[model samples]
Target: MSAQEEIDLEFLEVEDLLLRTVPGLAEQWRGATPDEVEQLERIAGRPLPRFYRWFLSRMGQSMGPLAYPSQDFSARRVLDCYARKIVAPNPRFLLIGYESDEMMPLHAFYDLDAPARGDATVTARYARGGDDPIDRFETFHEMLSWSSLFRFQFEQMSQKCEGTLYREDADLLSLLAPVLSSLGFTQPLTTGRYCGLYERADAVMICGGTPRENLENVRTFLLGGSNAGVLRRILGEVAKESSLEVEVNTWTPALR
Candidate 1:
C-alpha cells in the first residue's frame, strides 16, 4: 500500500476500535460537563476525534485520580519518578523521535531520586538491536501521563498494531479521570505545567495528516536547519502575547 493509504487505513481502524470500545462517546461529548470537556480540549488543543473522546469519557479503565494499573515501582526508578512527578504541575513526560523509516519502541522516564542535581533528568531506553540507540535527550517540560500515554498509544496503534489482537492502545484517560477532576488540590500557575517534546521521521509523516500535526510541525520548524532563527521568532511571539512576561534564567545564580 502507498504510504498515504497506509496512514488512512490506520487512522480509520483506530477510529473503529475507539467507537467499539467506548460507546456513546459522540452523544455524551455533546453534553459532557464543561470542566471535563475543557480539560480534554486543552490537552488536545482542539475538538477531539469522536472515538478518542469516547474512550476518555466512557470505555476502558475506570476513572479516578492518578491511580491506574499500578505496578510495583520498587525496582523501577523511571516509573517511580513518573508517579512521583505525576502530581501537580503535571510532571515531565518524554517522547522519542527518529527517522520516518525507523521503527523502534522507545521508553522514557524521569529519575528524580538519582544523583543528578539538575532538578530532574530524563533517561531514554530503546532496543539497541539496530544501528543507533533511539534518539535521546533530557529536558524539563511539564506534562501529564494521560496525554503522554495517549500519544504513545496513538502512534503505536497507528503503526504497530497491524497484527496484534487487542491493539496496544487502551483507554488510559479513564484511569486518571478522577485525579483530573479534583484539580483544586493542586496549584495551577507553576512552570511544571508543560509537556516534553518528541520527534521522529515517522512522526513527521504522521503529523502531516492529522489535527495535531502542528504540535510536531513546530518542533520540526524549530529543530531543522535554521533553529536559532525559529527560536527567536517563537520567543518574540510569546513575549508579545503571553501574560506571564517570561524572562530567561540561567544556572549562574548557584555559581556565584
Candidate 2:
C-alpha cells in the first residue's frame, strides 16, 4: 500500500480503538487541512516524516489527557520552544509531541543527507535533568502505537468493575494496569475510598494508595511470605505475556 494509505488505515484503527475505549477523550480529536500541514513544513524548513505528515492531515491535533500539544500550539511554536530550551545541541531534531504532563518533548531527527525513508529516530527528552532522551523509538509509528496501547489500557483500569481491587492514585494505576493485566488479573475494581482488588489464581490481591505505597505492599506480599512462591510463578507468567521487561525492584515513573 502507499504510505498515505497505510497511515490512514493505521490512524483509523487507532481512532476506532480510542473511540471505543475512551469516547469522551476521542471527541477532542481534530484533523488539520492540507494547507495547514504545508504551512507547518514551510515554517519548520524540513519535510516531516510521511506518517507524521499523514497524521497531521488526518488526525490533526489531539486534546485528550494523553495527547501532545493541541493545534493551538503550532508545530513551529513547539519547535521554537525546543530550540530555546534544549541543553544538548541536536540541530536535526524536530519536536513532534510531548508527554501527557508536558514536562518532556518527543522529538524526531531528520537526516537530509541520507537516503529518504519513512522512519525516523524518535526520542523523549526530560526538562530538568540532562537533555538526553530517556526513551527512544526506531520509528514514529512505533511511538504512536505504544501511546495508543497505553491510553487504552489506562482507560480499562479506570473503569468500575465488580470485586474491584486496587484503588490508588490514577497515575499509579496507569503504570500498573498493563503489568497486572499481563499477570492474568482482572481489571481493578474499586472496593473503598482508596483501595481496589485484582483476582487471579483464585485469590484477591489488595492494592491502593500512591505508586510507591502500592509497590511496597506488593513487595511485602511476594517476599518472605507463604504465598510468595505462587505469586512468583504468576509473575513469571506475566513476563512471558508482556514485551515490557517487568522489574518489580524498581518503579518506573510515567507521565499522566
Candidate 3:
C-alpha cells in the first residue's frame, strides 16, 4: 500500500479509539481544507512527506485532545525556528517537532529517504546541529498513536476512574472485562458515562469500545485515590496471566 494509504488506516484506528474513549471530545476534530494544505506546502518550500501530507489534509487543524501535539504541523513554525537560528534543519531531514531538555531542545525529524517505503522512522536531532543518536519511533503513525495515548492519559486525570489499564494494538477490555466480571466487578451504577466502563468497590476502569474491540491504552495510573496500592498487586496477577506490559505511572502533579 501507499504511504498515504497506510496513514489513512492509522488515522482511522486512532480516531475510532479516541471516539470510544472520549466521544464528546471527537466533536472537536477539524481537518484542513485543500486550500489550507496548499498554503502550508508553499511555506514548506517543497512537498511534504506522504504521511505528513495526508495528516495535514485530513485532521491537521485539530484532533480533539491532540489538537496541539508534540509533532509540529505548521510549516510556519519550522520556518520561524530556522529564521531565528534556533536550530539548523538538515536538508535530508523534515523538522516535525521539538522538545525542550535541560541543556537544549531536541528536534524530531523524518528521514527524506524512507517515507515512500511505507515505513519511515522519526529521529531526534540536536538543537544546534548533529544527530541525537536516538530513533523516536519506527514510523510517524506510531509516534502519533503514542502521542494520542499520552494526551488521553492527561485528559483522564479529570475523570472518575481510579486507575486504568491499557494495552496497545490489542483488545484490552475484552481480555480484562471477563476477568473483572468473574471477580465480581460488574458495571458501575453511573449514568452518562462510557458504556463499557467498569468498577468494583475501590477502583473504576474507563475503558470504552463496549462490544467492539478497545485498542487504546491508559490503565495503571498512580495519580490518586487509595486504590493505587491495592490495585498494584492485583495488576501483577493480571499481568502474569494476561502478559500485558503493565506499567506504573509516577504521581502526576495536580493540573493547574
Listing every candidate in turn, what is its Cα RMSD in Å to the true structure after a full C-alpha superposition? 21.0, 12.2, 9.8
TM-score winner, 2 or 3:
3
TM-score of 1: 0.21
Off by over 4 Å in 3: 1-10, 19-49, 61-64, 68-71, 79-91, 98-103, 113-119, 154-226, 242-256
- In candidate 2, residue 136 scores what lDDT? 42
What does the lDDT read for residue 81 in candidate 2?
49
Provide backbone clash counts, one per model. Answer: 12, 9, 4
Off by over 4 Å in 1: 1-103, 111-119, 127-141, 145-189, 192-256
For each candidate, the alpha-carbon lDDT, in order, equals: 0.28, 0.44, 0.52
Which residue pairs overlap in candidate 2's backbone? 164-189, 164-197, 165-189, 165-196, 165-197, 166-196, 166-197, 167-195, 167-196
Question: Model 2, stretches more than 4 Å misplaced?
Answer: 1-6, 10-12, 43-46, 68-76, 79-91, 98-117, 125-134, 155-234, 238-246, 250-256
lDDT of 2 by residue, 170-239 (tens): 3333444466666667632222222333445333343333221223222111111124355456545544
In model 2, how large is the Cα lDDT of residue 23?
47
lDDT by residue for model 3 over 64-121, one digit each (tens)?
5565534455445555566686765455676666554546566776665555334356
Q: Model 2, 178: alpha-carbon shift in Å?
A: 17
